[model samples]
Target: MENRQTEQAYSLYKPLLFSLAYRMLGSVMDAEDVVQEAFFTLYKSGSDHIHNMKAYMCKIVTNRCLELLRSTSKQREVYVGTWLPEPLVTTASDETDPMQSYLQKESVTTAYLLLLQQLSYVERAVFLLREAMQYDYDEIADIVGKSSANCRQIFHRAKRSLSVKGVSDTSDRSDLEKATNLVEQFMHALTTGDAARLMKFLSIDAVLLADGGGKVKALTQPLHGHLSISESISSVLKKWPGSFTCRIAMVNGLPGIVVYKDTIMWSVFSFMIRDGRITNLYFVVNPDKLTHVQ
Candidate 1:
C-alpha cells in the first residue's frame, strides 16, 4: 500500500487495534507501543499484495501482544502483592478519544481484564477477536494462525471460564446507572464515616483487594466480608493524613473514583456490582501503575 493508504488505514483502525492490544496486555503504555509498532511495520512494508489492511494489521498487533505476554510472564509472576491492570481513567471530556470510543466498557473493565489474564496468551487473542471484535471463527483463525476448529474451541473455553467467574454483564443501561449512583453514595459514605450507610451498599460477602505493586503501602492479601471490609475502610481513612477528595470518573468503563490526598493521586477504586450491591472492590495504589492518572 502507498503512504497515503497506510495513513488512512491507521486512522480507521487505530481505535480497534489499540483496544485489542490494551485488553490483551492490560497495560496502557504497552498497548500504545505495540499499536504504533504495527503501523510502522505496515508503513515500512509498502506491500501492495496485502489486500486486507485491517486483518493484516490485526495479525501484526495480536502476534506482538502474544510475544509481549510471553516475555513479561516472569515479571508478572514476581509482581508485588495483588496485580491489577493499569486503570484506563476517562472523564466526560474524553469522549473524543478514539480508543475510548471503540472500547466496550464491559470488556475493558478491570474485573473482565483480570479474568482475561487467567487465559493463555493464544486463548486470549482468539477469545478477544471472537468476542469483543465479533470476528468469525475463520477470521480469528487467520489472525492467530490457528485452525478454525481450534479457534472455536479456544473461544468457547475462554467464555466458559469467564462465566464460571460470575462475570456480570454491564451492557444494561439501567444497571450501569444504578452502579454509578451507588459509587457516588459509597464515596459520600466513605468520607462521612457512616458505617451504617456503607453497610447498606455492600453485599454481606463483598471482598476488597488492593494493589500497591510493592512501591507503596498496600494490603498483601484480599479482605473479605462486608463488615470487615467496612471496618478496614473506616480505619484506613482515619489513619490517612491530609484531607481527601474524590472525583467520580469512568474507571474501566464503570463509574468509579479517583481519590486524591492533598492533590496527589492516592488511589483509584473500581467496584464490581452484583445484585444491586457491591460484590468486589478493587483499590489500585501502586505509584507505578498510576502514572497515567498523575
Candidate 2:
C-alpha cells in the first residue's frame, strides 16, 4: 500500500519535478534522470518519516540538480560555439497550477535561461525556488540548507547578477500575434532568398547564434550585425537544395520557426523582437538538443 501511494504521488508531481529540473539543468535527459533518482531515493527511504511530501520531493530534486550543475560545469566550458537549452514543445494545458503556468511562460525563454547559466548553483536554486516555483524564503532555505535571511540575500544577488529589470508578460496575445506576423515575414524572406527583405526585418544590431554541438555543420562563431547575418543567410539559401519545409511554431513560449526535412525536424529558429525588429536569432541545429522538440 505504501509503495502504491508513493507511485501515485510521483505521478502527480512528475511534471512539476521535471520542469524544475529542466529549468535547472537545461537538458531533458538530465532532468529526467535527476527526477528518477529523486524518486528512487524516496522509494528506498520509505515515506513513513516524511510529513510534507511535496517539500521533501522538491528538496531532493533541487539537491540533485546542484550535484549535476557541479558535475557538468567543466563539460560546458568545452562546448563548441554558443550553448542553448533544449527546445521544449510547451502547451498552456501542461501545467495545473496557475502560478506555475505563468512562471513557465517567463522562465523557459532562451534568453532568460542563458542568463541563469551565469549564476552559481546555490544562487540558481534560491532564485528558481523563490521566483519560478513560488517557494517562500523559509522553504527555499530548507531546500538549499541556508538560513531564510541567507536565501533572501542570495535571491537578490542572483537578480543583480542577471540584471533583470522587470518581468514582461510574453503570454500576452497582442505581443504573440505581432511576433507571429514578424516571424512570417522573416521566414518568407529567408525561403525566397530575398536578402533585402530579410535585412529589413532584422534590427541593425541583430545577432545570430547557432548551436551544432560540434556534431553537425554550423557556424563556429556567432554572426553579428544585420549585414553579416544577411550575407550568411543568403549564402545558405544559394547553396540549398530546396528540400526543407519551414513553419512558425511556439518555441520557448514565443513565436519561432521549425524547419523539417520530411518528418524529421532539421532546425529550430527562435527570435527576440524589439521595436518591430528581430534583435536576436537563435538557430539550433544540434540533434542531441532537438530530441525533445517532437
Candidate 3:
C-alpha cells in the first residue's frame, strides 16, 4: 500500500485497535505498544493482498495482545497489593453509536476488567471480541485461529465465569445525576475529614482496594466492609497534610476523583456506586498507573 493509504488506514483503525488491546491487556501503555507493533507489521509487510484491512488489523492486534498477556503473567502474579486496571480519562463523542458507547463503558470498568483476569488469554480475547467488539462467532474464530464452535464455547465459558447480569445502560440521566451528587459529597467528606458523612454514603459491605505497585505506601491488602474502609480513609487523611486535594473527575467513564499533593497527581479514586451508595472504591496510587490520568 502507498504511504497515504497506510496513514489513512492507521487513522481509521487506531482507536478501534487501541480499545481492543486496552480491554485485553488492561494497561494503556501496553495497549499502545501492541497497536504500534501491529501498524509496524502492516507497514513493513504491506497490505496489498489484504482485502479487508479492518479484520486483518484486528487479528494482528489481538495476537500481539495475547503474546503480551503470556509474557506479563509472571509480572502480574508478583504485583504488590490489589491490582486495578489503569484508569482512563475518556469522554463520549456525539457521533459514537449507542451500543458501542455502552460496550466501551462496560469493558473499561475496573470491576469488569478485574473479572477478566480470571480467564485465560485466548478466552479473554474471544470474550472481548464477541461481546465488546460485537464480532460474530465466525469472525472471532478467524481472529483467534479457532473453530467457530470452539470460539462460542470459549465465550460461553467466559460469561459463566463472570456469572453476572448483562451490562446495564449507564447513560440513564437520573442515575448519572445521582452518582455525580454522591461523588461530590463523598469527596467533600474525605477532604474535610468528616468520617460520619463519608460513612453515610458507603454501603455496609463497601470494599476498598488500593494498588501501590510496591513503589508507594499503600494498603498491602484489600480493606473490607464499610467500617474498615472508613477507618482506612480517615487514617490516611489524618496522616496526610492538608495541602493534598481531591477533585471530582471522570475515571473509566464513571464519576471519580483525582488526588494531588501540591501540583503532582498522587492517586486516583474510582467508585462503584449502586443505589446511591458507594459499593466498591478503587484507589490507584501506583505512580506508574497514574501517568495517564493527568
Candidate 4:
C-alpha cells in the first residue's frame, strides 16, 4: 500500500478502532495500548499482508484486549476485595459532547460500565462495537472470527443479559442539573464532614465502591446505603483531622470531583444519580489510574 493510502486508512479507522478497543478493555489507557500495538503489528509489519485493512486491524485490537484481560484476571482474583473497573475519564465534555454521554458515555456512568463488567469479555466487545459504534454484524463477525449469524446471536444475548441498574435515558437539562446539584451537595457534606447533610443525599440502598488498589487503605467491600457509607466517611474525616479538598472537575463527561492534597493527587469520585438521590459512588484513589489527572 502507498504511504498516502495507509495514512488514510489509519485516519478512517481510528474512531472505529478506539471504539472497539475501549469497549473491549473499558480503560482508555488499555484501549490506546491495544490500538498502538495493532498499528505496529499490522501496519508496520513488513512481512504481513493486511487484506481488508479495517476488519483485519479491528480483529487484532479485539484479540489483543481480550488477551490482556485474560492475563489480568489473576490480579483481580488476588485483589484485596471486590474489584471494580478503573474510571478512565472525568467527563465527556473534555473530549466530546456531554448531552448524549452514555451513547459515548460509558466512561461517565459506573452503571453503564458496570453493565460491561457483567459481560464475558467477548460479549462485551461485540455489544459495545455494534450498539455504540454501529458496526455491522458482518464486520463484528470478521473481527471476532465467527459467522455473522453467531455474532448476531451473541450480541442479542449480551443485551438480554444486561440488568441495566442506574441506567438513564436522554435526560433533559433540568434532570442533569438536578443530579449535578445532588452530587455537589454530597461532596459538600463529605468535605465538611457533615454526616447529617450527607445522609440526606443518599438513598437507603445506595452503594459505594472504593478503589485504592491496595496502595491506600480503603474499604474492601462495597459500602452499603446512607448510614454505613456516611458514618464511614465522616469518621475517616474526623480522624484524619485535615481537610481533603475537592474541586468540581469533569469526570467521564458528567460532574466529577477530584479530591487532592496540598497540590498532590488524592481520590476522584464519579456519581450515579437518579430519582434525586445518589445511587452509586465510584471512588478511585488508585495512584496508577490517578496519573491521568490533568
Candidates in order have lDDT scores of 0.87, 0.82, 0.82, 0.74
The candidate 4 region of ten consecutive residues with least summed lDDT is 97-106
The estimated TM-scores of all candidates read: 0.93, 0.89, 0.92, 0.86
TM-score-wise, the better of 1 and 2 is: 1
Instruction: Tell me the spans in candidate 2 whose CA falls farther than 4 Å from its real position.
Output: 91-106, 166-169
Overall local distance difference test of candidate 1: 0.87
- Find the candidate with the highest lDDT and give its number: 1
CA shift at 95, candidate 2, in angstroms? 9.4
What TM-score does structure 2 among the candidates reach?
A: 0.89
Return the lDDT, model 4, position 203: 87
Worst 10 residues of 3 by lDDT: 91-100
**Please, what are the lDDT tens digits per residue for candidate 3 over residues 1-294?**
367778988878887888888889889888889988988888888888889899899999999898888888899999988888888754444227543454345557777777788889999999889888799998998899999999999999998898546433246778877888999999999897767777999999988999999999999888888887887788788786586788887676677889888778898898888877898899999999878767
Ranked by TM-score, the better of candidates 1 and 4 is 1
Clashes of 2: 0
Higher lDDT: candidate 1 or 2? 1
List candidate 3 segments past 4 Å from native.
Answer: 91-106, 166-169
Encode model 1's per-residue lDDT on 1-294: one tens digit a residue.
388988899889998898899999999889999999999998888758788888889999999999999999999999988998998898888878776776745378888888888898998899889888789999889999889999999999888877545677576889888998999999998886666778889999999999999999889899999998888887787776447778899888888899998778889999899888999999999988888885
